[model samples]
Target: MRPQKIEEQEMLNGFAKLFKEKGYEGTSLAELAVVTGLKKASLYHRFPKGKEEMAKAVLLSINEWVEKHVFNTLTNPSLSPEERLKNGLQSIQKLYDDGNTPCLLQAFSVQSGIEVFHQLINDSMSDWVDAFTNIGLAFDLSQSAAKEKATQVLIAIQGSLIVSRGFNNPNIFINSLTNIEAMYTQE
Candidate 1:
């Protein structure tokens, strides 16, 4: 019955930041409490199922964001395909903090986290591929070509993110996005 101290979105953002920095197994209740400015008991009060529940909430929050900003923008009929691609990439850049932040999906792919989140991860990835495939279709690519292009785009983003982080360079990530735009927008 106590009033909430932190707002829901702010709390989730804190949880997400820690989860992104450290995988589920590496993240701890103490660390989560410190990041969120919430006591351990308060977090337990909010997420009775504990770390798993908190991780699920964070993933769900991220999924909702992508659905709205990325998928919705890509599929909006009012915008031209090039415009949609530009907007979608902007959203993605924001999502990753221009490669300074690691991917939430990759963070959760460690053995312990993946076992619990495999289906959720798989389904979310499929949704990403499907969204990009729609964009490829808009550019007049055949169905098979569109799907192949979509998969390549996903691979390129993931690979570039890894290499960018490894090399301590955001330009690699930015250049990859530029290449992706050219791949689709070029005649």
Candidate 2:
């Protein structure tokens, strides 16, 4: 991984936070420029395609972070399935507690108002589902069962994020996880 210049990293992080909080449609180029402490012209100099380019860059940054942090931890060979799931849930909860923001991917999908953004959203979601399915398979779930469970877990997570955001309660996410666990144990 190449090290980003501090200014570039700051821009990416600012965009990620803004995108998470405001969604794609709600955030404007001027607002993004202000958040990054750059003039609109300077922002454009760094991201020539303008807001769309910045959005894509923000998504890519978040995607890479998720893969390196959450996905990698969930798929670590030394962890048990329960341990992995718990850690994943905890990581998500921490994100909510820190910012009270919705999932960046979901926010972008709902607010981008562009067909290509929809395709990008689908691709990102598929990657997440595939990762969850791989983790389930490591726990001896059959392929179909793993996929199904992975889908359920993803749904639960997204739902929990919505609920947590609305209610301002991070524990709602843990409660949702309890429900997911119950589904797994129930005959």
Task: Score each candidate by Cα lDDT.
Answer: 0.91, 0.78
Best by TM-score: 1
Error of 2 at 65 (Å): 0.7
Runs with alpha carbons beyond 4 Å of true place in candidate 2: 1-6, 178-187
> What C-alpha lDDT does candidate 1 achieve relative to the native structure?
0.91
Which residue pairs clash in candidate 2? none
**TM-score list, all predictions:** 0.96, 0.86
Q: What is the C-alpha RMSD of each candidate to the true structure, in Å?
A: 1.1, 3.3
Question: Candidate 1's error at 143, in angstroms?
Answer: 0.9
Instruction: Summarize candidate 1's per-residue lDDT along 1-187 as a digit string, tens digits.
Output: 7778988888889989998888888899999999888899999888999889999999999999999999999999999999999999999999999888888888887656356699888999999999999999999999999999999999988989989988999889989999999999885
Candidate 1, residue 5: CA error in Å? 0.5
Candidate 1 Cα deviation (angstroms), residue 93: 0.6
